[model samples]
Target chain A: MGFRSLKTKLLLAASLLVISSGVALSLLVSDQYSKSLIDSARHQAENLALSLAIESADKVLTHDLVALQKSLDHQMKSNRSLAYLFVVRDGQVLAHTFQKNFPQELLDANTVISEDGGNEQTIVSTTGERFIDIARPIFQGKAGLLRLGISEKSLERQVDELRMKMGLITLFILLTAIAGSLFLVKRITGPLGELARSVENIKQGSWDVKIRVSGRDEVTILAKSLINMAARLKHYTQRLENQKLELERAHNQTRIFCEIVRELGTV
Target chain B: MLFSITSIKPIAIFRVSLIIITALSNIGCSDHEQSKVVNFSNTITLEKPDTKQRGDKQLRVAIGAMVSPRESISIYQELLDYLGEKLGKEIVLEQRKTYSEINELLGKSEVDFAFVCSGPYVVGKEKYGLELLAAPEVNGSHFYNAYLIVNKDSRFNTIEDLRSKTFALTDPDSNTGKLAPIGWLKKIGEKPETFFGSLIYTYSHDNSILAVSRGFVDGASVDGLIWAYFNKTNPDLTSNTRVILKSENYGTPPVVATRQMSKSMKEAIKRALLGMRDDKRGAEILDRLMINRFVPAKDDWYNSIRDVIESAGVSMEPQDGLSKSEN
Candidate 1:
């Protein structure tokens, strides 16, 4: 394939630069915002879990599973961000709000805590949906875990908004850059185009044609050099023309003299 | 040939430099986005621990009144200077016209200390780690009431009589002005939008009170402390105003410090305030402020305020908290 024009190359470069930077900025802002949102959500989830754990502490101490289920439901309904709540005891699921099974990774025995509350962990399903799960340990006769599951939709929404804003800004930058590049290339190359036309005229024997050097750029310098060269060639050609005329005049005179000498000598 | 060579140097230099710059810029462009992402994330992590500690030295403090109000600014400046002298540091007091501005400042940790109404302190404590240092004693008690005021000539006698009339809320985040009225409305199975013909946030208790007295709004809720202050100092505003309803007593506005402050500094600040009402020099400033005393306080004084926030269905989570930390 033929190489692209310099203008095309420069424009492509500018566009790539703008897009990459914009994408990076968007990703950065989104990531920061997402992490903060997640942390906030985690803290909120922890607080919710603490409240739920405290509210059901008496029932949990008595090992009343039924009352625990009702309290979890009540708490989940009160918070719109909450997706599900599950109570686990002795590495077995005692109750869960959703019919879908909890991920085994989150239910790992080592992941479960028996004291000092617990930490939140994120899980992504095979379909690429994300969730933040906060697990708090309920200690009574037996160690139980109270887990609050919150959807990542809110964070995702925020990230999407940032991405959209960045995308628009990138598009604006790319368009301006491409337009500017084209305008600059045309402006700088205009003198070169004029120089080419003047050279063509010189080849057609129009040596007297004057070339103008209007700019301080390289193209103007090239025009000035070409004009000087044309002037020198014209000077040298004029000298050669004078020498030819002188030789012709001398030949004519010599012919006349030869005829006169021949006639006088014959007489 | 020598002339040509000399003439060509500048062109060659110019062309080479342009090519170099364009190439370098293009190369840099490719990685620019990724670097921004990396940098922002790094900043979040690096700055998290220092977020609370960053502006500690400057001592950003806000007063809950218009900065242009001569009386409010004078009282606030007096308090700040007094505190500054006790702490042996220069104090910068920020003035916010609305309760929301004070809340936002406190929430962002932009202000280290604030003299905010009981309502904003309650809402901010749960979201941002706000600790009560002292409560202002006026009229011999550390408590204030919210008065529902109407024009003196208005026929409205009770809260129910003001239905379908325009009402002015001091601020959306205000406790006594917005939350308390909403609570009363809720008890009667009505909402602000359903009960009032129109509602607007005046952004200040003084402005809301003025709006009610001027007949721009049919009624408004104001702090009794402010009403008393105007009654004693600027009676012209109160000449056309009369209280029609009153809310139960709630703790008065308090001086609050961020939870991030050091124990020693917190103690020094509390000592400075508690002694202010007793010291002859400090008492002079407090007397001009119409403050009777300053008493030691705790976090529990704001429980009623928390109850109002909880009842209002406002969530306390910082929208950017987790995402910023992760980045």
Candidate 2:
């Protein structure tokens, strides 16, 4: 709301620019970070699932069913991000790492890739948490599928952390820019305020009103202009006062002469 | 009017300056409170090589030597490639020369699946937790014989004739090569270590044939399928030997998987194998490998071979405890 000076208005405009751009940059960076986190996490999960599938192939062939179950359970314990795991053999549920509420949909799908086998999909857990379901074929499906569910929460957590950091950085940049602009505005507009203060004195014909002009910049130039204008007004006022004094003297002489002429005529 | 004209005081100039300073300070303070320096670097985006990225996972397979490593690859590489194609994963062939090595690989679960002899199948299933995947049916039978052969000129007519001569065995884990010979020796109140003057293992049926053909050993035991394979591919080796003894037919060697394999994967593999003979590429590879087609096998089908091995009760354990060179 302040149009106090051109300098002040310009400073306000610069502050607005800095804030808007900072916010825009923060949002753009946050979005990119979220996408990157999700993509990389899913890829890492895929690599791990495939390795587990390969390891389980011989164990399944050897009728070492307990080994696979125990392995899945052990992995789940160490990896908190691992939400669930199941082993299905001969179209029957053999073992799983789930505590309860097993997803029957996973088993029903068979996920059997006839020509090409490995597959992954997204799923929502019973507790309303999101997860990525990865399936790998053991012995190329000569045996069965090793299904694993990984939580997406960890990915989100990382993205959240990144966003917070970005927000802080944006705020920092914004404030720094605003402070810088305001400081510049004060330096440029200082002389204007000084001139305004002495303006009344210059208008009342007090020629002694002298403003302290600092620096050899635009402010100084404006001060010199104001000083010249005040000097001209003082000169014109002095001339007018002298003219009025002369006119008063002339009028008094005329009144005295008229009175003497009238007295002589009456005698 | 001139008296009323008063200049702005110095106090008003101070107020304007104070406002500007306060605004700048406020901006600075708020910025300090809100702005935090953050490093925007990460190490999460490395690239993977195309070769290493095969199917994004590696599945290992072992082919226990029915022959030498070179021959095994030549014979089974096509089938493994086909299987890999069907499974949509990379299949790495783990080649080991001796049946015991294959058994060890199975026991360690280092090998995902294997094509192994019937002799080693029982041993691995008992000791390494191997489950049968499928067996090859060659020439309309899912069975194989153990051939006891002698040089064409040798006067060896029966098992007793070679009692005091040097003999060659194929592999310790071989049903036909080691167990069959032991079965005969036990039946005659003798054993391989005591009955023969010297015993050497060739580690392959064809290698044993080469030993027997040149009279390096007076006699040897070999697989019937291998004998036929040699006969069809290279008749010179087979023509030089005569069958002095033949053991009863036993179930053929099978492709076995581990117990932890998923049912869907098992189903897919079984389906691919069963349908192999129907496909031209698969059939051609089967012919080159001297196999008719793969058929589903159950664990109980090899009971007769198991009985023969147990009946021998003779130590077929490796003499030097050294596996043959993979070369």
Candidate 3:
């Protein structure tokens, strides 16, 4: 039972190591991927907003709203991560990509934080969609402001995909490690089991049981020690048997001698 | 007896291997993640790098507001570059919101040459002796007309049907875009101020076209050449509109030079334009612009435009006065 429990403990220990290390590796990789993906997305958002601002300056200044609308539409087609885009001049929306009514709340939702209009905010639309609203100044605020909303949904989806992939990989590694640990436990416990059986045979007064084990490890050393003890025990048992036999023979002879004397005196 | 020693070594080895594997994996992941972020942020630059040398001789050329600014860039950037390459000078493209501003740029010699509207060319010639260099030969003709258009779905089938509806004009100093349309209105004893329910100046013919196509305005008058060009090239926009009226033909807008430009430079520019069709690159640009070639400018070609403007009782000031009042 004890030996069986030893196998259980070793298996538990191996499982614990694999699990802990796998969790740690998964966390490290997932965190890094999440951070890098978010940073890249934010940078893309900012660049897109900036380029649109640059392109929209002349159109806004000239009051060419048709051209501005065309540009906004074109830009919307190229980026799927974009939620919505518009241009605001003098607190009025000049052109927007909205197919229907423009959201009035969005105008006051995010404002330019910097003098040159590089500002951003996290906003939740009425539809429950989350976005990173980026604002940029056109002609240093002389022409207008360009407000672009980049959806965070795609980024979240990407990070989730990375985590899922990482989790599967970690699980594969854990399973392989556990299988390796099982093989190692068997290799280790196999020798100890043989030694245990030999000791049981000795307890049953059978000294002919083989206790020798082969290896350059501690188990082999233990088997060697057991073998030496068994040898001494066997020698002592043989001497004791010889002594008992002599004693029995002597006693018999004495009895017989006594009988002869008695026959002449009290046989 | 040595079971403790036996179990402890394997566990220790396992633990050590686990640690080493985790460390190596973490190292690999961190390096990859770092490189990925670097690659993502590396190529984004908002400003274009200027590759032209600063010491090069520069020629300032102004393009009038014939098309919207964005379209102007796509259409003319190459032609300007070709001109710069042939003349061995850096070309600086100047643009204005109105044709009058472009003519004013030529009036002050702020620009070496300009592509001006026929109306501005006529006014600039009388006001400042603006010399004509050459005219584009579109469909073997040096003349273009004005087109009054409405949305294809509109109930208006004629210009009179658009009496009290909204209307769009291209620019104040444009012949086909404004003068010809206003002249037709005046001939029928009506004024744009009181005739249309609302009026908006789009500053470029393409914008007017877009305005009509999108139903932002019920009617718009645009340069016929620009209308035809868009009809063929951008049918998505032009297919939404139907032309209802066509005006008498006027001189096609001409390339003009400031009086301060030397005669030799004028001749050289004329030669380059006239010979452009023979050069492969120049021929491509011309093909994109839908021009067969360039021909010598005839002064009498623009007389019809002058007659129309005069008959409409429109007196244009020679300078920024007309542009400012219209604004």
DockQ of each: 0.02, 0.03, 0.07
Write candidate 3's Cα lDDT for B73-188 as tens digits.
67778888988888888877777788887888799887899888899999899988999999998998999899999999998987789887888878778888778878888878
Best by lDDT: 3
User: Candidate 3, which segments miss by more than 4 Å at Cα?
Assistant: A1-19, A35-267, B1-5, B10-14, B17-24, B27-56, B126-129, B277-288, B298-300, B311-327
Taking the tens digit of each residue's C-alpha lDDT, what string does model 2 give over B1-327?
355755444445545545554554344233211111211121122222112322335567887766765556556778999989888878867766578888887777676778899999988888877888899999999988899999999899999999878888888889988888888888888987788888887877878888889888899899998898888888998899999788888889998887666677777778888889999988888888788889988777788778877776645577653334211
State which candidate has the highest DockQ.
3
lDDT of 1 by residue, B203-237 (tens): 56777778887888899888888887877777888
Against the true structure, candidate 2 reaches a TM-score of 0.49
- What's every prediction's RMSD, in angstroms? 19.3, 15.5, 12.2
Q: What are the lDDT scores of the predictions, listed in order?
A: 0.69, 0.74, 0.80
lDDT string for model 1 (A39-111, tens) is 7988898888877766654444333457667877777778889977877654556666754444454454224
Off by over 4 Å in 2: A1-28, A60-63, A77-80, A88-91, A105-120, A126-128, A136-143, A162-185, A200-209, A216-218, A236-267, B1-289, B292-312, B315-327
Using lDDT as the yardstick, the better of models 2 and 3 is: 3
Clash count for each candidate, listed in order shown: 12, 29, 3
